[model samples]
Target chain A: MKQISTRLSMAVHTLCLIAMLPHECTGDFIAGSVNTNPVVIRRIMGMLKKAGLVDVRPGVGGAYLLRSPEEITLLDIYRAVNAAEEEQLFGIHVNSNIKCPVGRNIEGVLQAEFQAAQSAMEQQLSGVALKQLLSQFKE
Target chain B: MKQISTRLSMAVHTLCLIAMLPHECTGDFIAGSVNTNPVVIRRIMGMLKKAGLVDVRPGVGGAYLLRSPEEITLLDIYRAVNAAEEEQLFGIHVNSNIKCPVGRNIEGVLQAEFQAAQSAMEQQLSGVALKQLLSQFKE
Candidate 1:
């Protein structure tokens, strides 16, 4: 049971800290909050940075949201951390015996269903903004 | 950028073959259609067998759906193959620092959203039956 990477949740957790405590979001500080190593937080922050969801201030070492919390949906964070994995959320075995009619066409038949199912999950993700998740947190 | 295991799709493909060509579903046959090794087919079939979705004959090595195609939903196959991974489809990072409010509460806040997103995906899967996928395949 290989699980989907934990990067997605870690990215979300990273972003929450950035939103909740912008001044305190140095890599180490954030890593402490995430209960992981600084290197892991740095890696996830790098992805977030590339996605234009967050920006890291150089020299001083702090991060902040590039977009408003409401503008950044869970889908955004999900894509940021897992852009590569999302391209094929559901993988069809490539060498499916082409001789068998069922094998030959199974991939093509399952294609739309996989996409629909992935889209349904992402649709729920897109519905939840980082602001929404942030508001759910208690002081 | 890790992806969910291929076992889910492979299991579905195996089920499709079993339901479509009941008599020819020897492990080798299904493996051929799946374009994978017999061992791979054996592993997936074991999961399906354990779930009681399919029965494997002892002597000659053939498999048949324990339930009709209509009775078997994609969700069942999904569960059969990836039961271990689904317990927490969206895992919250386990070590969030309890000292920080956001870190301490992020897992709890995100729990419902993760469950909802997973449910949306599973809902789509459960809605689709093996019969529906089989009907889409060509002769």
Candidate 2:
């Protein structure tokens, strides 16, 4: 079955938690909130750090969002996680028979459509900011 | 890694081939072009048949498109194949720690965003007719 990366949602969740309470954002704490292994949280945190969306200090450090929730969109989280390859939003069957007319040309045709679809999804994601999501949480 | 269903593309390819050469679309032949097992082609063909997008005969028969290529869209093919669940497109981590405020509410927030993104993708898919795709193939 086709699946979007779980990492994207987890990253957003992690960031939202950090935005909500930045001081207590250790990997262990985030993992507890995310309900995943600290190793998993660290992996995602590593990606977010690389993307400049989050900062992680050395041995004694915790994680924190680099930007305000209001300034961060789901698109930002998505890109930070690097969850899904844009080109792979609709995969082309790799072993298509090139000798077959339809097989030879389907990739080009489908790719254009896939690109459009992916762009639409990204645009939709961009419209939703982390602040909007954070606001949904009850105190 | 996250991936979109290849079945959606394969279904389009299968239909394109059937439309291009209506007479010789046996499961084996389609599988050759798809470069997958005949059973795989049959599986997709079964879904297409259920969707009323294609017809299959009992014995000594093959697959054929039930509608003209112009009448079919990638959205139709996507739905036919049930490519990805709209909710599953952005999976919420099932194990979120309910004790955390953000974790407790994250699913509802992400779900709404995922729904919007899915709608956008579906709308984009609906706009591209299969005939438009088939037109890209060289004779």
Candidate No. with top TM-score: 1
Q: For residues B1-139, could you state the per-residue lDDT of candidate 2 as single tens digits?
A: 5567788888889999888887788989999999999999999999999999989886876767888888999889889898445535766688688887888888887888899999999999999988888778866
Model 1 regions lying over 4 Å from their true place: none
Tens digits of lDDT, candidate 1, B49-126: 999999998688788988988889988888888768447677677878888888788877878889899899999989
Tens digits of lDDT, candidate 2, A12-99: 8888878877778888999998898999989999988888888988688677778888888888888878744553577778768899
**Shift in Å, residue A23, candidate 1:** 1.8
Candidate 1 chain A has its poorest 10 consecutive residues by lDDT at: A83-92
Binned by DockQ into CAPRI classes (incorrect, acceptable, medium, high), candidate 1 is: medium
**Candidate 1 Cα deviation (angstroms), residue A22:** 1.5
Clashes of each: 0, 0
DockQ for each model: 0.74, 0.70
Which candidate number has the best DockQ? 1
Candidate 1 lDDT tens digits, A15-47: 888988889889999889888899999998999
Candidate 2: clashing residue pairs, number:
0
Candidate 2 — which residues are off by over 4 angstroms? A83-87, B83-87
